[model samples]
Target: MAKAKVTDEQIIQVGSELQKADKNVTGHALCKVLGGRPDRLIEVWEKHLLESNSDENSLQYIQLSAGLEELFQSMSNDILKSIKSVLATCEQNILTQADKHVENEKVACAERVSALREQLNDANDIINQNQDQIDSLLKENQIINNKYQKTIELEKSVVELSTKLEGYTTAIKDKERIITEQAARIESINAA
Candidate 1:
């Protein structure tokens, strides 16, 4: 027959002996711990510790006369309040730093906007200067074009005046020929 598994009571008795002998209680994590169900085995060691410490454990001996109990409660409350105050201070410091950071960002943004406006003004000034130069160049070009048109008209008038002079010269030569012929005829008649 398979030997029956060792009981939790038996294991507890061994653990107690080991404790009394000042030896390590369970050499390992209860993997080979004798006998009990696995779940019970785990709690068995804890039960041994409680059983051994029963008399010495303060929480088990609970005869608090109201006064000491109130003092302990007051002490815990004060500690909690102090902890909350420290947390609040830390939170306030974080908020202050965040506000300062936001202000710095706003100032930096304003400076950037001012710089961009200055650049825009500079660009506008350059554009106006270029436009003024363009207008002056256009006026000069108009003056040159007008002078060229007037020169062309003057050349046309000179050509028409030369044509009229040619016609007058031809008529004068014909009149001079007629007068010379009449003079010759009159001289011949007188001679006759």
Candidate 2:
């Protein structure tokens, strides 16, 4: 009764009903009951069924084909669902890996920043130490310069003292010569 192919089973069932009613049926009657053309091959097929034995092989082939079609449809649906599930899982894994990679990069960046900060701190410490050393060197140089200046002033004093000592020695020699001349004149007059 379904609106699709005219299956032989429906024809056979109608013929059986006609037989039970003790009424003789023909191909035209069967086609009329099935709401098809009485001159169609479907009517001839029904007539063949009434005359000869049914083609069991063809019937089996049709049944098997229908079963295979149903099975193939079911398998296709199952495969599509499985493929969708696998694709979703793959997408989730990709997202998770991306998140982990991002976190790792962040951690690496933080570590690098920490290392750079430490290096900067160390550099600052070195700079401060160098500054202290420079200051100490400058103080030492200033002290040395003061000592050199004092030594230069002492050398000038020594030069002036040496010049005065030479003048005093020349004056003492002149006085000694005059005393010797006076003693000689006194002895000569007494002798005269």
Q: What's the C-alpha lDDT at position 43 in model 1?
A: 71
Candidate 2 lDDT by residue in tens digits, 33-145: 88665555346555766566556555645644788889978999999999999999999999999999999999999999999999999999999999999999999999999
lDDT of 1 by residue, 1-192 (tens): 765376667777777676787877653534354644556565777887787688578676787779998998899899999999999999999999999999999999999999999999999999999999999999999999999999999999888888878878888888878888888888998899
Q: Estimate each model's TM-score.
A: 0.51, 0.52
Instruction: Give the total clashing residue pairs for model 2.
Output: 0
lDDT of each: 0.81, 0.81
Model 1: residues with Cα > 4 Å off, grouped in runs? 1-72, 169-192
User: What lDDT does model 1 reach?
Assistant: 0.81
Please give the lDDT score for candidate 2: 0.81
